[model samples]
Target: MSFLIKNKLGLARTGIIKTAHGNVETPNFAFVATHGFIKSLKEEDYFSLAPELTISNTFHLFVTGKHKEIKKAGGLHKMFPLKNPIMTDSGGFQVFSLGWGKKHNIGKVDKTAKNPACVQPVDKSTRPPARDVSKTTCVAGGVRACLPTGRLEKDRNPVKILSDRVIFTYDGKKFELTPRKSIKIQEDLGADIIFAFDECTSPLHDYEYNKKSLKKTHSWAKECLKAKKKNGQMLYGIVQGGIFENLRKESSSFIGALPFDGFGIGGSFGEKQMEEVIGWALSGLPENKPRHLLGIGAIKDIFIGVGKGIDTFDCVIPTREARHGAVYSMEGRLDIKRGVFEKDKKALDKGCGCFVCSSGIKRKDLRILFKENIPEAQRLATIHNIHFYKKLFGKIREAIDSGKRSNLKKLEKHYKF
Candidate 1:
């Protein structure tokens, strides 16, 4: 399996990723379906919204049943019952093993702006914190973020899963994740594209720690390949070197030379550092192989990523954000439960040209429908966000094919890439 870069705009590119499952088009987006399902969107809905290949989680599945069980059940392809190609993470990235950081919670700064119910609770420190009782926000037309406040934190406790095999602690629990276990799990799941077990470090870590972690990851990746070899399955080597450019260059250069099918840009760079790191990593990477940016799938980020030569990205942003009643559109994003759309008849994106937009579902109708149930609400939001993702990639790829990919930055203001 290999990725062929057919066109280039600066460092950005349009390409094709040939996988055993099938093929994933370049500059594409894959919605995360951890465990067996995507939260609110049905498999049919997903195909309808984007019709692109998708990826699933490996760690979560392992926790429930052994990988051998899945292989007996006819592998992930039969278990998930999908026609498009599928990809799986190596289960080593602490994020998947951990969840959002419940066991040993760290570095989640709270950003609050005028207590909007549409926005989640803001914690000045710690992970996702409690909601501000003083704020009021809406989701859909009239669906207010009207939580009673006393039980929000208890309801949505997030954490990261690790690969150390022992359940590590966070807030107050242990999250034990091991590499061998992850490899076994993904192998049974049998995804077309698999990632190596790499530690996702924080940007605040010192140079020595970063260097040590990267080296460990390299060794672990090699071991992962040895332990979980599968015919037609492709493995990806992650490039991790934190915010230091020299380290990033070295890491990318070294990882690029390895006998891996593709590459993934893992953590160590948060939102602020995302673009710069992509630029540095791609500097020494060969254009022949596919490059993926892990956990980034927003519209603006999509443009920036494509412009910087990322072929694929996977994130729960669309479905997760939509679960909170937020929706993305061509014009921009607005919380569906906000006060502004209470009676608005306009679709989430008037020009979106998707089924949901054409469904003529009123905001008030959606709000009332969701009050009846969260799944119904999540479905509508998922529809809109999926459309947004599909459109972003489609436009970028079109630009690349048309020899105008360089102008993609004009779609947004910040031109970091």
Candidate 2:
């Protein structure tokens, strides 16, 4: 795998990531294909959209035992019949999503009205016997402090975190995933690019919690590198530091120094601190390698990430929102299901060339389809939304290639960012 930089404008640049499958343009958006396919869309629908890249979830495939079938079919590309490059993230984000994320009810960004404590203690009944539990101190909110022996005590949280692995109870079945296991699963999936297994911290975590988590993340990165045996797959290390600048820089420096093909900025951030957090995360990475901003794809955040030097990104916003009847446009997102659009005859997006828009689907028509629970509503919306982001990134690459800040400024104004 190789990355060739073709143009640069400040931190933002246009480049190509060469892979066994194909070359993916830098400053691009990788749509989420968690189950080896984009949700609510058929093969023909995706072929029409023809996304540059798609990212699958290692955790989901592994936990659901789908990796076996994927391997049997000669990997994701053969199974999905895709010609574009693919990326598979180490099941690391599940460390947060199934752990603190579920416990605190928060996502990558903390937008809750009330902030929870960084460390909430688990219920006493869930702890081990007094003799065994005495060795470790319980932090507030049920989080157990690492014992002097370097072992972690299980908490009441649905997901259990240990020094060597994570335990998840999904669909009433227990699944254990270690760094080595994560790497093995990615190899079975045979993605062109795979990520090192690192714990994704929550925005609610404090300095001490993140500090300890970083130690585990850094250690796991090394283990992942040692476990990878595939010759063609590119491995990217992940940087995790919650929302702290110092820790973000520390993690970036540690993970960046490793010999991974590229780097991914992971972990959580405050709603308004994404730009600052991204800057800190990229501070110590090698300038020549590609940088991916994990799990972020909002229109405004995409510009922020590109301006701060992120090369690629993956998120479910476009497809997930589309499935709910939200349509993407330069003007803004439109709720096509709303009654206000009952008589509207406007195109999904004026002058857009997406399959749905080019076919001349009217707002009222889409509204009627959605209101009647027709499946085509989601299919059309997903295609339109995916195309919208693909076009946006293409224009961003053009703006960067032109070496004119005014071009990018026009994009922000045009996109209402």
Candidate 3:
């Protein structure tokens, strides 16, 4: 459990994270395999793509009853046939999302966009204002009236937040997930890396409520650390404070002072607050340990994060975007389903050196393959996007090592993100 930096330029560095399965290169991108596998791609597909690491969701695996089977089969890499390392989330995000966010018509991580279908009448006869909406935004009070229709939908079973545990009701049954339970589950379905159970608060939560929740999350962080087993799995303590600067600093100080192997920056926030919030949290953390920025995978965000000292990131964006006919290239995002690409004979990306482009596969052929709705198109598109991300990290690392970090700034303007 050692994170040794090999090179550094400003806060960004190229490092090696020592893990049980293997070493993960720093400033790396982890492919999202939420349900034990990336969508539209099988275990065999990963062998060729060979991501240095993959992130799985604990909530999905536990609810689907796959955790027991995976534990019995040994570990994620062995059970899933992946040669690289694996990291499992504490499922805290789902708890907030399925319960609070759903009830209030808010998204877990997204805040910029609005959903039109989520509009519903505000129920004034329900809960009191103290427990309902706030002055600026409706969190609990007037939630139905204040929010846009596209962001929230009415749901019956959302999670209930208690001081010690989160109650999730699904399919007519209730499941109580405590801090200790989350750690035990992660240990059961062993992965090279695991996260401490903490409350991932929504941005809609006001400062007073976020402050109270921060105290609860801090309590859970200690409980998780105390309950965690030293079975060679690296445990990462998560920092949560919504978007308040003072709370962010406090949460960072509390979580960073702990003896966990690593640290993860968690909680909901808008795009404008990302860099400033991250800077606040990172300022409190020790420079020696690895720091993972949770649930961020956009290219522009990557540049911002790496420059500010984040070591790793995980998101479902690339693969999910690929399934929706979007792929990343050096030029920018390419939509294979576009009518223009139906006859375009050029490669998916002229500057891309991935197998799909390097093998001379034209955009028209790829478009037709994808239009046929075959699995190969999705897989190929996913692979190309992944390769682009991997290469991006590689270039970032190289720029840092060679003392030419300005190249990263240039990429920001070139990509226009």
Candidate 4:
């Protein structure tokens, strides 16, 4: 429950989160450990990649029956042997994206595209259908390799949302994920930071639907706070209003007035509306408390969120994108699998100081790694990309500390959201 801010440059501030496991530096990235572990990397590898915090999915863990195992192992830090702080998402985004998105064949977050074809599948691959080898992935270097998706399969147990609870159907059995239940599960799993259970509506949801959903979110936020036990774990109340400004202000004000430790900016918005809603929410939130913008990790998005006073962020983009050969460069993303890189001798980013780039691995060699389907290739790319994000955020903090906001502005040309 101890969060201290040591410095502020405009809206951006440097801070630390004092948790039972360890302290996490602010203006930091929280990498995704979707099902209680980072994909394609071992627990020890997390120590080397060095994000101050990691986030796990509450819904995924619950569905996969890992929640009980996680608890039995004495919470996430002890189970994973991570010395850093841990955060558990409320499972709202996955409910909206995987369950809700699949039900309607709508896009996960983008609101502009009405056609289902315009929506990109959550998986980026165009390869032919493969077997469902997801559960039988090989363990290498003491880490379980992540399984790639096979044929697009409809979610057998789509999440049915209601005002008080969400019904999840998995394995032919129905499970209810209520606000109170979510809190208890997270408590048992015991992350340093956990979010209140709230409904995360798709960007495709209309204003009327969003308004109705926000009311439920507010009620749940209160319930989550009431259900929280005094265990020194930080509970962040989620703000949900979709893309509407008025609703955003109302939702923010209600959640911000509560004595919760921090705030999580939830729900989805059109790309053009993202900044406005984020600004509105931050305007109403308590400045002394930290704010986490959920499920956004693009470099431009990070810059925008940081500028808007968001203290922390968690996204699957760095590692997920790297697994697909989309890598971050100061110049923007470099798709290593592309033919252009097949014979290119230059490093992924000559200016980068990451292990891969520092080792002088050329673009052609990187392309070969993915082309030949080398397993370590994904891990190396993930490490380098994560390292790149670390460096990027470091630069962001430095720019803010030195009042070089213009440098951040210039970066807009390279990293467009």
What TM-score would each prediction reach against the true structure? Answer: 0.80, 0.90, 0.89, 0.86
Clashing pairs in 4: none
TM-score of 2: 0.90
Which TM-score value belongs to model 1?
Answer: 0.80
CA deviation > 4 Å runs, candidate 3? 103-105, 108-154
TM-score of 3: 0.89
lDDT string, candidate 3, 225-312, tens digits? 9999757899999998877789999999999999989999988765566788889888788899999999888888888899899999
Q: Which is the leading candidate under lDDT?
A: 2
* Higher-ranked by TM-score: 1 or 2: 2
lDDT to native, each model:
0.66, 0.85, 0.79, 0.77
Residues 1-417, model 1: lDDT tens digits: 767778877777788888776777788887777865577777687557644766787766665554567789877777765656677886655452253322223221112221222222222222333454433433422222223456545554444322333343445544455666666677778777888877765432446656776776766767776776567777888888766678789888888878778889876454455678788877777778888888777666777687777889988888788888877765566677766777878777767776777888766666666666757788787777777777777877887777764356555552222
Q: Candidate 2: list runs displaced more than 4 Å.
A: 113-156
- Candidate 4 residue runs with Cα over 4 Å from true position: 105-108, 111-157, 410-417
Determine which window of 10 residues in candidate 2 has minimal summed lDDT: 121-130
**lDDT of candidate 1?**
0.66
Sorted on TM-score, best first, the list reads 2, 3, 4, 1
Of the candidates numbered 1 and 2, which has the greater lDDT value? Answer: 2
Q: Give per-candidate clash totals.
A: 35, 8, 10, 0
Native-vs-model 4 lDDT? 0.77
